[model samples]
Target: MQGTILLTGATGFVGGAILKRLHLEKKRSVVAVVRDSSKVILENVPKVCIEQFDGSTQWEQRLDGLDVVIHAAARVHVMNDVEDDPLAAFRNVNVEGTLNLARQAAAAGVRRFIFISSIKVNGEGTAPGSAYVADDVPAPMDPYGVSKMEAELGLRQLSLITTMEVVIVRPVLVYGPGVKANFLNMMRWLDKGFPLPFGAIHNKRSLVALDNLVDLILTCIDHPAAANQAFLVSDGEDLSTTQLLSRMGKALNAPRRLIPVPSWLLEGGAALLGKKALSQRLCGSLQVDITKTRNLLGWAPPLSVDEALAITAKYFREHH
Candidate 1:
């Protein structure tokens, strides 16, 4: 924990959060790997440049003397993929690039490699009253999920054959300050006081705040039991879509204006609009059980969902 740590994706949202945390700690010497060093916001952090998805970087030399490597960079999932071979595109970065980085890290005698994986690796969603556990069999539905699963399996194989330790963390939808993508869009919609037809949504979703996810990553960095293990993490509280929007409204000081619509009608409408996937995500249950993570690492999300939401809301008010 006190030695040099090389972190990828420092310019990204989650990675930026992690870098901010590391900056405050000031205990470890952190080097950020990025395409353009000038864009790195965190000063005092050294940087190395590498072309993503190419596997063309000189990693062995770059990784030398580094104690830990936190791999958070990958080809993220695009909601509407335009690539003809989406799986191949994802494999290029998430699988091939990831394994290449790990192989070099292991060869360079790095002590540990922490991989940021997705809950999609577990499956699309969960059944009502059931949640995904750490030991659940991987059933990736999309190309992106498949790529992450492949990288995880390959990293575990490397760990078994090599001396380098590997820790895999699968996090649910992560939200915090500077959050973008669908979560950000949702926040904007709620902030504008747009009425949503999710009042009757009884489905539960497990989400991890950016702070909580960063804490887990830091825990895996030095925890001996974290080696060769995979963890499922969240805020330890599940909320329905209706509840989520209501909280967002509270944070934004907007009225909770939601319309009651049956799940069946919502699904039917989404199907007609070619937004079935979006509907499934908005109206379906997707909970992660973090009991293994809690019992094994003696860890719990320090921030409650509402506390995290408040932080996010404050940031939004100031920025957007």
Candidate 2:
């Protein structure tokens, strides 16, 4: 049976990945709430309607007979000045706009509402030798995480008050083809035959692939176990920074020469030069336990870390 789905962030990296997958499946009719629906990311799939990012889209009328709503838009940044008002900007889009849509969906009797959140809602970085499970307390640290946490709380609260189902997905450092910024920088360095100075730094981190995340999102669309549940998601595999970079390099046909840099020295330099954010990226343990997501939803991340890396490498190879 063909169903109707409303997807925000449909043009973004992770969301675009989801849209690419959805394009292949003819089972559902997907309508995206885009900043620009005419600016197509994928061709010959379908037309994206509703050309805005706010709650004023009269979504209540449009959401009529919809099966699911995927809220994947949010304010994203690795670092921000504390003095600046990122929260206000995010709230306008993330918090209030999200609730507005969810409320409209609930009013229209939509079946499920899926939210794409971040592990930053749990903690900035996973503690050493420990991973966050579904039951762990949420202690959001930054403005972005705090806002996401608040949105999660709002969704949970709304679910309690309404008949709408809510499913939340937390992705950790999702990397695949078409990735940008820090992850891309790492790939670029590897592409140029530069070895990352991260060898021998054994810190485990969890990551989700673009394809795997799409699979999970589709699964969550109708999965009964996702109702009113907050689950931590990972690739079901953890690797050190060096290992991840190495796999990426191999996938790109780039040389893999890793230099052993002491973790302490690297971290110390970052801390000294206001580069702590980069340090966290280079050396941090951010593992998440996906046991609950698997047990409850009967779903598993489809791609192995290596498989995802290879795909990303291939993407760079083909594109470059």
Candidate 3:
């Protein structure tokens, strides 16, 4: 904790929040690695700009004298990815690039390499009550998940042969201020009073607030128990789609107009429209068991679901 910390993806949602927290803690020995320095608004934080972040990128000078390297930069999962070879694209950056950085960091005598992985590495969803634990066998379904899974594997292998400790943190769907895509759209629909068909969605999902995730990452930075270990993180609470929407409605002061559409009917309709994956995400269960995370590192999500939801809603209303 006394030495310099190098953080990647400083402009991203999770990374930005971590950078802000580090800044608030008045840690001046932090170096932010980014593709665009102008996008990073945190003052007094040194930055090293790299135009590209693939396997060939060099990090010798950047990793020098660094105690911790938080690798948050990756080709994130997106809906309907347009890449001709999505797996290759993700592997190029997520796997090869990550391993490349880890190799260099180890050679440079970096103490620890913390990776921000995704729960997709544990597969898409869980049964009604069962949840994904830290040691679950890898069952990544898509190219992105496969890439993250590969990255985790490569990091673990590298750690076995090197002195640098590796920590992998796999978080569930993360949402907070400045969230976009589906979560934002859900807020929009709620604000507009659109009648959603999620009233009957009894499936539970585990989500992490940006604050909670940042706290976990920071905790992993120096915790001895976290070294060479993978963690499954969540808000420690699972909510049904209906419950999530109802909470959002309360946070936004918006009327809930959800209709009790049968889950089978919704799935069938979505399959007919070629939106089966989207429907599964909206109406499926993807819970994670964080007991290992808690017992090992004594870590618990510092923010409640409703508290984080309200913060996210407040930001949404103020900004949009």
Candidate 4:
């Protein structure tokens, strides 16, 4: 808690929030690793450069005095990757780059290395009543998920024979201020009062707010029990698709006009349009039970879903 912390992906949505939180702390000496220093939106925070996500990048110098390395940088999932071998491409960054950084951090005497993984490692969808836990076996469907799982396995192996402790956090869909992708598109639709056909699609999905995730990462940095452990984190509340849209409408102060369409019809239409993946995300059940995280780390999400959604909505209105 009192030592220097090195953060990667400081320019990303979740990473930006973490960087901002660290800036406000004023207790820990923080250094952000970015591709370009000019793109670092946070002022007064020291930065180092790593131009590419590759194994060849040198990390010892920047990681020298760092007590904790929050490895948030990765080759994020792309809907349509035109790469020759998408799996190999993901492995090059998410797996190879990650292990390289961890190995260097370990050799540099960093005490803890926290890897931010994805819930996709647990699989795509869950049973209606069942929720994912840390103990679940890896069932990564796509290349991105598989790469993250490999990184987790490699880091755990590294922890076994190294002095540095490794902590893996598998977070569900993370949304907050400056959020993009599907969540942002959904918010935009709601803001415009677009009637979505999710009224009858009753599916539960788990999510972590930016603040909650940042708090968990900070807790893992120093918490003795969190060392060499994996945590599945969320807001500890599950929401139906309809409920999520309704909440977004409320946050945006827009009309909640959801058309009551059958789940079968929605899926069928998505399949016809070659949007099966999108449909699964919209109508699938993916929940996580954070009992272990709460029980072990004595941690709870500091923000409720409504409060977090309000913050996201306010930021979107002001910025976009």
Among the numbered candidates, top lDDT falls to 3
| C-alpha lDDT of all candidate models, in order | 0.91, 0.82, 0.93, 0.92
**Residue lDDT tens for model 2, 189-305:** 999998677887789998888898889888888777788887777789999988888888878888988989899899998899999988987798888999999998898888898
Candidate numbers sorted by lDDT from highest down = 3, 4, 1, 2
After the best TM-score superposition of candidate 4, give how far the Cα of residue 287 lies from its true spot, in angstroms.
0.6
TM-score of each: 0.98, 0.94, 0.98, 0.98
Q: Kindly give the number of clashing pairs for every candidate.
A: 0, 0, 0, 0
Tens-place lDDT digits, model 4, residues 1-320 = 59999999998887888888888988798999899857846778888888987888887578778899998888998887899999999999999999999999999999999999999999999989999999899999999999999999999999999999999999999999888999999998998888888999899999999889999998998999999999999998999889999998999998999999998899999999999999998898999999999999999999999999999999999998
Clashing pairs in 2: none
Error of 3 at 103 (Å): 0.3
Query: Weakest 10 consecutive residues, lDDT, candidate 2?
Result: 44-53
RMSD of 3: 1.0
Give the Å shift of residue 199 in candidate 4.
0.9
Which TM-score value belongs to model 1?
0.98
Kindly indicate the candidate among 3 and 4 with the higher lDDT: 3
Worst 10 residues of 4 by lDDT: 36-45
How far in Å is the alpha carbon of 208 misplaced in model 1? 0.6
**After superposing candidate 3, which stretches have Cα over 4 Å from the reference?**
none
